[model samples]
Target chain A: MAVRADDIPVPRGRPRLAGRVREWLDQESILGPVFVTPALLLLVLLVAYPFLMALYFAMSNAFIGRPSEFIGIRNFVRLWDSDAFRQTFQNAFVFTGIAVAFKLVFGICLALLLNEQLWFKRFIRGAVLLPWVIPTALSTLGWWWMFNSLYSVVNWTGIAVGFMDPPGPNWLGQKYYAMTAVVTVNVWRGLPFFAITILAGLVAIPRELYEAAEADGAGPVARFWLITLPLLKPVLAIVVLFSTIFTFSDFNIVYVLTRGGPINSTHLFATLSRVVGIDTGRIGEGAAISLYLFPLLVFVVWAQLRFVRKQAY
Target chain B: MEPIRRRRFLTTAAGGLAGILATRVPPARGQQREVSYLCWNNFAPASDKKLAEIGQRFTRDTGIKLKIDHVSHMGPQQAKYASEVQTQAGHDLVEMRMHFPWLYEPQLVDVSDVVGELEKKYGKAISSAYEGAHVNGVWRAVPQYHGMFVATYREDLFKKASLKVPDTWEDLYTVGKELKKMGNPVGIPISQNYDSISTAGPVLWSFGGMEVDKDGKTVRINSPATAQTIEWYKKMFRDCMEPEVLSWSDASNNESIQQGKAGWIHNPVSAYIVAKQRKLVTADGINHHRSLGGPQGRHETDTPRHIGIWKFSKNVEPAKEWIRYLLGKREVYDEYIMSGDAFNLPVYDKLQDHPVLRTDPKYAALRGEGVQYHTYGWPAPPSDKVQLITNTYLLPNMLAKAVTGTSTKDAIAWAEIEMRKILAG
Candidate 1:
């Protein structure tokens, strides 16, 4: 039965004025929107405006430090038809999909490992985050050294250990290996954040809930599925969302590791954008590549948010 | 007595006035001197340390302050300096990256006229550094330095393979194929954002490719010479260069050579300094030497980098004095070249022609044989727009595309279109 107006329950210690304000605020989503407005404005100014400017640029022939001629979608049309841009689009999707998928699986496994009680737990915890804690530039440089064709320890180890033939693999050399190397570097750098987030969620899970499940004779996997996962659903949703955006837009890994590759095998949006915009000075085309990444990003964000809202306790 | 005293006073006053006039007029005839230096990159790389030293010496010899704000090399560093210039900065001297010449030429005080005066006072702008800067009805630059390219190979590998030193692109290719079968790489820098003009010049000239006419006219994207050279270059990569070469845009690939990972390359003559620095070669150890031409018949080497007074310099006299002392002063030039801290060429062409160059029993032969005999940069693209061609990526991309199944006709057409667009802008 629908509660009658007079029978509605008021929150404890709520004054009449507070109740009226709450009702009004609730109806219009007033404070909710106001709480969100700062972020909204920042996004519009920083992300949206630059993006729209890029979109506008993509419709014309523009150069760096110079005025552009309006060509009415000619730049976009040309870019879309071009082999380089097409390859860039394909690369972005493949890289993000593969990277995110690996991060999710690896992140969960890492989170589970870290959740266990072990000696030097705090030290081990900090060490696990060393990759993420180091500046991207420095660590990327370290990776570059490690992957150097002649001087690489990785290559040296491979050859010495009879892992392969005489010359071992140049981790960043061939087309296929270049992509794999780039993806591996990216996953290695990014997995820490997700694992930490999930680990935090795992910690917050009530001991009583697991105890109760065990008392009811629920098996290990059943307890995980019924209680732990259901509880962590909100956290995992947020984790996937954050990692997707980070992995999708990372430029430094691709740049330092492979720089697209021997055959454009690893060209992603950001590197391709720089090549076209800064290097070639085809500012319009480069802007177009970045702008194109937006809708796909938006779709992922929306899906994540929807999943998050559904999982709220 | 009173009449005598009045006459004395008048005589004293007149004498004082005469004394003041004499002092003022003599001082007016004295001259103040100024020196100016340009920041053009090709020449000024060595100019900085050498001039700073000379500036210190000049201060000891003559009482004058030296101003050195010429230019930095192109690519990222000059971007820092360009912002300073654009905002109406009073740059004293800058190490100019060529092509920004358009940005600097009009702004700098013309030191061309003063260079000849300094030459008489000292000697001609270090004879060999002069790649004809004062011709074509324009007097803008003065001569500076040359860091040319030459061919280098691995001694151990070449000895084992029993391959002769490559004379041309074909021989380099042959050597690469044979070496690669042994799992060694021919480490030619296919991507030359590292030494764009120096590296590209020798390869193009090795196959006899013309850049642009010294008089700026049109794009020569697919000259038969350039096309043939590119075809050979692609084969060099295909046969010898490792997958790592594609990943590198800088000297990391050269470092591969130093690390003993690769075999032959057409590299900077400066590679000798690298080998020595890494202790790969010494009075005791073995190392390879590069000459002008390779197995290729006709060749080109880089013009020694040239220094010019930026039309922008404030201290033309001091700059001119500093440039002169650095170039022609025997002690200064020798100190710079022998240090091996930087790549420096001799001031006099005759010094290079001595036993030290071709027949120096100790110094490895760099005769006319493999050395491409052309010089660049003292005269290059007249405008900054055309200067884009001198960069590493544009041509290499075109060539890479062509080799990776991009049809030559289509490739040339596409390259020309892209090049003309960049050149025009």
Candidate 2:
């Protein structure tokens, strides 16, 4: 016989279960987590898992294809004593510090110039981005050709302009010169990001504030110092932080240009990691070398975030 | 009723997940024969074309499929091999170069059967071939070919300087100095490049210096002979070579000679071949000769190539068959050499007199140079430790440190320390 829904003896937990599920489905908080579950899972698998694996590998005596043993901090300790690793660590700091500083200065100058009412402004902005827009490996190859000792166009230009004596400078042959050449290329490639980003920040600044600063009898320099600089601090901090990270772990420019050469003068953390980890098949040491900069990068990023948060508050 | 529905839903979802995972799992193979080979980019495109043609022919003959992957021969290729060995996955067959057979010996399959069969047909292989492919009394790989380093120089420059072609290291230095005075410097890469390692090998050996002993257990880089080699390089860097040699890549020496700025280079015949092919410089403008003799003896560096099947490969038999087929037939091997423009030298004694070498005047000297060819860590059996040192470029870096102003004693001392650390590890 057919039975009514209420006529059937209600299961002991049926009503409670229905109520709980309905409440969970109806609540926005529950829905929020449910909707984000896929993304969270992806984040764990893609980003967090590899990062954790790298951490594990760094602590183990792992060679590619060979079984690994837990070696504690031996990899880190060895890298600490390694002359090559020490030099690479030092190179990372110097290369990033100089590259970021120049990128900022040039970026701001170019942004200011581009902001002015001028002919071909759009064209100039787009053209300025070619170095950034091109694939880094391909662009660096072009730079390599230009830095060639015998067939370098830069040397050719210098010779024709009489700015250099015969034979010209070997742009990538000496320690100091190679460092300078890599830094210059880094700056050249990174400038567009800063320019476009800072330009956006510049455009976002309300015109009324600048007008008021000028009305208060401020000169161009005074208005810039009082209004433009303060207004651009947050954006500048962000751009600089990104550029710093990119420069610190940079592999393509150094690898393509010198392969950290002329005697390991230009090796960065990434190239050194490859040399140790992949090339030498010392995955453990390579992993340790790569992660050595993690703590410093965390500090830099955290400080920038805190500064941004303080400004926001 | 509600609990039952929820349980049903959970079960359905779990089953769906299981189904997805099952689909992702590779299906079991019955008897389909297929293998993939990974190798470095050939010096000439025609060489790759020849290889592909042979692969297709193999497929036709045996009903087995062959796939070949060619990658750049430098850093990336090394990384690929390391990755494959570490992961225990990738390519059924791989081209092993230099010290790789020894470096990854545990992961490679024994190819004694292939090598033995081929040797029975083609006489004895060269000693250098055995030096690279045979490790621990096991044939780890099949010796493929040798890329010999010979001197490529400008005949025009030598004529203008009224100097004969250098037959010894001293003569090279003397000629190099004269060329430099004329603003045409000899370009021997003093930097950390593959060519630098090859160029340094002969010099170090010629001076009777070695990085390791014949047992591959002792560090011998701190000898007086090594110190003398360092001093000689310092003088060469100061007087004969351009400062730019410190930063030269593997391609720089080729470019320097092609552009008419370099008077001499120690490279494979690729430079000369390219110059003639491109007409960047005419054939008459360029000339090639055997490596210069050092005080100890006349020797050259050999970057031998080998073929090995991975232990983890599913189609090991097919991989072995492919290697045997490629290396066994003299006609096919000679064709490969011809296609490569004589860039690849035969490892078998019988094929040494192949028409490819005998026909070309430029390749004549190289034909017999293999007898005098030596690999790095020479006299010493190549080991993983030795491979690590080679890859890290410790030897070249030592010379660079010395030539760039670090004292010879200090440079050798540093190298000894580095070598010890590598060996100990």
Candidate 3:
């Protein structure tokens, strides 16, 4: 029963225009592209355009409000000579390394604790996400107030409790202490994200493995070490990957807390880029600073995703 | 005169619209005739409110509609201007701070005529304003107002201690030691902020050290004068100030004095103005003295704000009208200046003795009779490179390093290298 299009009966009150549209939409190739066109357009306009522009700016001698020319990799090469840029490069690693490590350890413990049968589990789980739920800049301002040199409530409380000497440590005034303050705030803000994602991974782990381990006369520690740890590898990998990128590019905490101060000790790539590019009107150098880590980040993403796929298969 | 018909009306309307679009010109009925201005959120909140009110009145008096927008004074304001310039769009006018006119000279419309007229009426613009808005022998922007750094101190404490008002930076150091012993340390910030640069510039200039030579190319931070300036700061940080100044924001010094912690601070009169407005206990105790002098001469940092019209703006004429209305009219300008509570002052020679100064006794320090006020880069022309040095916090960082235990010579060497790199680039 091969039917021609002309031989098919048209429905009553269906206009020819509507019928033609319906026929076009019924085809997979037409409908697929039609549905995806808006999203593809948005991605091109929003993400790809800016990224390509930044790429161009990074390689060119672009100053704000002035005509620029493409100058090869000179901007990228020149940034290496700057002490601030070098300091920023080192700071980015130290900040991300310490902040992410703390988040991972704390996240696992929190997720493990959350997995147990506890009272008011739903309420407790919701409450744990408060740091991540609030806006980063707004929440960081609260942290700034706590760490302020003049009106630091942290020092006041510590002195009141006899836990610290009067006036306490200059958290934001000293380079090391400023770095510590920024990292502590970063970990506090990012922990909820890691914990919640790890919790989801924890929920998906089958109970049968633990039961089998227990039947084999395995202890609680042995069961967790052999079963729970191995199963959470892929999820942990994904969480760490995201956290590393986010932490490396972090701007708000350090900006509000130190403004990359105490001698550029806490400047991440993003804040340094803003200083060189926007504040100083050297958009070329600024873009270069921002994109300096792009290739490395891309490699990290690729390697992590490949590892994730290997685990999946 | 023919009677209108439906077909004729449609044809006429379509043709007119096509003509207007092709020519990129609107018909009389289609033109909105509006201009927008972008400025910073003033330290005095009332000034921002007064600006809005004046904008409304300007709209009512003139046919042109005016819109005013304010941004946070520090990072966000510069970012906003950069974005606008990059996009070739945004507000028609921007309130530029200090050497911003030089930074965006190409994009700013030449408003020499407006500036010339105002100059004739109000004597010449002050030296700092002239340095700021006058770029490459042309008026790139109209000088609006200036806020100068003055020595804000506790008068009551001085009276109680029977101390002489310090006339020189060295004298202040002598008095500052006693003030610290009395539990109120000097609150000069050595941080990465404009205020840090503000105090550092005057201190450096008064000691006759400049970041760059007047040629705007030679790195001059490595000088005997700079060493003396650093030595002054090192001693000040060690004895007269606390470690907290290293972390202070622009507002922190103001808060330190207003909260009765800081005995003296190099700042504008905003601190006392804010305290008086809030009826703080320290308001009565606070008074300002003329900016302190050094062995060379008296000097201070002047923050002159200007209005610049973007080259891309279609409403240039309307924008100029707004500027003339706000700044050219003496009474309107005075009303606006009065709202700033002496934090904002006239930047013209004739209007230097503004009535706002007479309103408060604490504002007398702002007169700065013998002090030579300069923007961030004093001897050096405020070119983009000099601005870069200021924006990079090289001066403050250099002082910071010195005060924090890096030898003054090493700090000066570091700053000289950094400045030379910027200048060469």
Candidate 4:
């Protein structure tokens, strides 16, 4: 089977010329490069250049419709001085930490539970992704309307049931809980992707291995611990890394929810970067806030490389 | 794995294909002096009808065309302007106001002569509309309408609650407190913007607290008077508004009031039109008048909705001609006045006694009411600082902190620190 798969043709490595035409063989390798050129160019143009430019922007006193000045590290220093920036950074961490943690644990548990001989299994699996399927902006808008105190479902339930007569609390307005409200919306949107990814990994696992573990007098938990989790580690690492990178760079959820309001309760890196850079026209400061995500991406990339290598250890 | 990969490929292709099909194909250009107007939905149905007639007339007289691209809000409109200016995009006429001119500085041209003619035709009261449209003695825009920084309340509820429209700073606070206890959203805003900040500031000013003074120089928010004002506003938020207020936009705030959810709100004359469009209130409930007197005196700022012909226009000649038709003639001004009272003033001084404004022969009353020193006093901040001051250091946020038990001193101090920082930059 291995030889047959190999014999099908590993075309990427094929030399195209004989001894008289070695240079032509080098030119024939052009087909390999040609096929992926557009993607390579796009990845650099769209992703890499913009990332580098953002770092450059962070070091300058840049603003729109105005002349830029080279104010190296001042914007970063200013961010440290600002209470708003400090609060925004803290909120971003808290939101990403809580939401990602919930998505991981619950995602794995749900995936394992659903990987069974259940009726309507496909339908249930598809239906679980309803939250993820909806356009994020539209869904976040729905969440915003639902949190409305005058006609909000949350407020309605709180006020009518005598949860507290005078004030059921201004969930969005109160600084202590505004962050929690934003995190809840973020977590709800994220859970489905994590569940689906882990479920795919679970289904790909060999049943014989699990049965062999069962023959060793292992319970379901033991088998999961010994077999399923060990096999699922690579995908789980990828899933957590993807969720962390994306969540750390989250702008839309917090922007739509609070616009960093109720006294800077929910300002995150992405939204604050926009407010400082675009809306406030402090492009330098905005770029500084945005560049914080780079270190995070670096960690993810390192983990990704490590995850791809298979080892007995 | 093969089936899944094929499915993914097909799914991505389908999404992209659908997007291409859904876009609107642009119409082919014809030879004509065409101009594009970029602004918000200042002219709703009434405003739209007047504009269509005026546009057709302009096409007839000068053989030029008018392309209308009115948007729904000011924030996005300003953003679009910045983008258009940067790329030198295709807007010929743009409606901008207040501090927006400073952001562009000398990028726009002056039309002081045309503005002067309209001011003469509409009367001296009209000159007040140009208060913030001119930059350093050069005019860049002409006033289309006036939107004063005022609060709107359910007049019927006010009478029912025995609230005689609160005469002083104390009256507003006491009455607002009373109204809250009896189940009324004194005010709630679900979104943030300059409109919210501008209206909310007057409430603070009534207690002898001004965020930025008449000259647009000092940030006097750290004063004892300012602290007291903020503390009182904090009380208003805690005692009165819905929590959803902080979450609402200007339109949503209007929705709250129109839906009978909120009793009072600091808003513009546009609210009357908004209510009319939503059919929230009948004809009888659309009351127009001045805001309450401050502890010092009854006063407010001149909030005019203005329009401009961009200096960077693809066809500046046609745009300038269009601006003239929109506001040049007396009859055109009348059409604007009738269009949901767009201009916010009556055509004839004698005829200002409509049920929409003053009752009886109180023609001179509006002049005295509107022409107060403080109302025309404060110098408008530039557009860039306007965004920072309004969005970052708004009264609603101040009220939120105070209500949430953020120390009054700390909130005020921090706000001052931030406001001064932006101003200095």
Give the number of the best model, judged by DockQ.
Answer: 3
- Candidate 2 regions exceeding 4 Å error are A1-26, B1-31, B369-371
| Worst window of 10 by summed lDDT in candidate 1 chain B | B354-363
Residue lDDT tens for model 1, B25-125: 42333344445343543332444565567777777776555555544354444444444443444445454422333434544456566556546644555
RMSD of each: 13.0, 5.9, 3.0, 10.3
* lDDT score for residue A253 of model 1: 87
Docking category of candidate 3: medium
Candidate 1 residues A1-313, lDDT tens each? 8979889876666597788887878875687797899999999999889777877777777655446788876655566655556777888888888998998889888988899998898998899898899888789888888877667788788778888775567576566677788888888998899889999999999899989999999998998889978898899889888887787778888777766765466888887777666544556766777667677789989988988887783
lDDT (tens digit, per residue) of candidate 2 on B1-425: 34568888899978877976788643355346899999999876778999999999989988889999999986888899887886778999999787678767788899998889888887777778888889899999999988888888888878977988988888888888899999888899988788999889889989889999998889999998899899889989999997888888898898888878888999998888778778884456888877788778877888889998889998888898898778877777777777878788788877777777765777776765533887877878887678777877888999999988899999999999988887876
- By TM-score, the better pick of 1 and 4 is 4
- The i-RMS of candidate 2 is 1.6
Candidate 3's residue-wise lDDT over A136-249, tens digit each?
A: 999999999999988899999999999999789998889999999999999999999999999999999998888888999999899878988889999999999999999999
Per-residue alpha-carbon lDDT of candidate 4 for residues A1-313, written as tens digits (9 for 90 to 100)? 3567656864453444343356644676865787689999999999999878778779888665566778888877767766678888888888889989999999998898788778999899988899899988789889887775555787677778888665565666666667877888888899899999999999899999988888889998899888988899888888898898889888878777767776777888988787777666666777899886677689777967586565224
Q: Rank the candidates by DockQ, best first.
A: 3, 2, 4, 1
Displacement of residue A257 (Cα, Å) in model 4 is: 2.3
Chain A TM-score relative to the true structure, per candidate: 0.82, 0.90, 0.93, 0.85
Worst 10 residues of 3 chain B by lDDT: B383-392
Separate DockQ for every predicted complex: 0.12, 0.51, 0.74, 0.29
Best candidate per TM-score, number?
3
In terms of docking quality, how is candidate 4 classified? acceptable
Q: Give, for candidate 3 chain A, the lowest lDDT window spanning 10 residues.
A: A8-17
lDDT of 2 by residue, A195-226 (tens): 99999999899999988888889998998888
